[model samples]
Target: MTVRLRPHHLLCLLTYIGKGYSPAFIAGLTEIARRVNAGEEVVIVTGPDDICAPLLEDPDAHCHNPGVQIRDANAARDVGALLDRDIRHGLRMVLTPVLVAQMRAAFANQDTRSACARCDWAALCSDIAADGFVGAILQAQDSTAE
Candidate 1:
């Protein structure tokens, strides 16, 4: 079974180090990070109801079974859709110079408020983005290094 990951998932994989969310969520994210670090292609589904639903409903997965609200799910789906669109347009890999720039621009743009407003790590993430994403990526990599 494949998991359709979003830009938020990419952000989490890059910055999360055993903080926020459940342990299961952290572990799942870590696994995804491992795949990303290994240069794996993270597939992303296109529709709102396709991938986010199962992720929200599964206990051993992203949501820990409590089931995410519609708003949250929609937000995640929208972020994923944006990431997928960027990827299709030659953003071949996540964390590349172009992709990072795109992510930073998306976060900084006022129009994308819904993407970050609901995030628990928004303040810190915004600070990280503002300060420079390379450091944040390295910090996350170092923190997760085995």
Candidate 2:
């Protein structure tokens, strides 16, 4: 059956994945979203726990069973850590190019901005220097250039 997709539904989906739900659970959620979007009453069936609490809080979010999954704390933590590590490692591979480019651009912009703000050629250098030496080499370069 299908249920209409909503903000809370997406939130729960993300929250569940973040909380280290199994691949099966993640696939189930994808089907649920598809069914829901197709206009079926998709009910998420998961054990009760803090992990799924956010979905429970939403009145519209329905579940078959509402109670915590009775796993030992140590087991749960280990599983959570393993899942987190795997997921992050996967993401690092997938996102490395984009993330690296973004970081490079950000660092470059920061360097330029810092030089512009603290360089001797910068209008505010007098004020900045009075406070303390800031990015002095770049400032010196700017002064020599002028």
* lDDT digits (tens) for residues 72-120 of candidate 2: 2222333224334322111212212233233223333332122132223
16-61 in candidate 1: lDDT tens per residue? Answer: 4444455655566556555555555555433332224435655655
* Each prediction's whole-model lDDT (CA): 0.47, 0.30
Give stretches of model 2 more than 4 Å off.
Answer: 2-20, 42-146
TM-score (C-alpha) between model 2 and the true structure: 0.22
Scored against the true structure, residue 9 in model 2 reaches a CA lDDT of 30
Clash totals, every prediction: 0, 9
Compute the lDDT of residue 91 as modeled in candidate 2. Answer: 22
What pairs collide in candidate 2?
1-40, 2-35, 2-40, 2-41, 3-36, 3-40, 48-67, 48-68, 119-139
Q: What is the C-alpha RMSD of each candidate to the true structure, in Å?
A: 7.3, 22.2
lDDT of 2: 0.30
RMSD of 2: 22.2
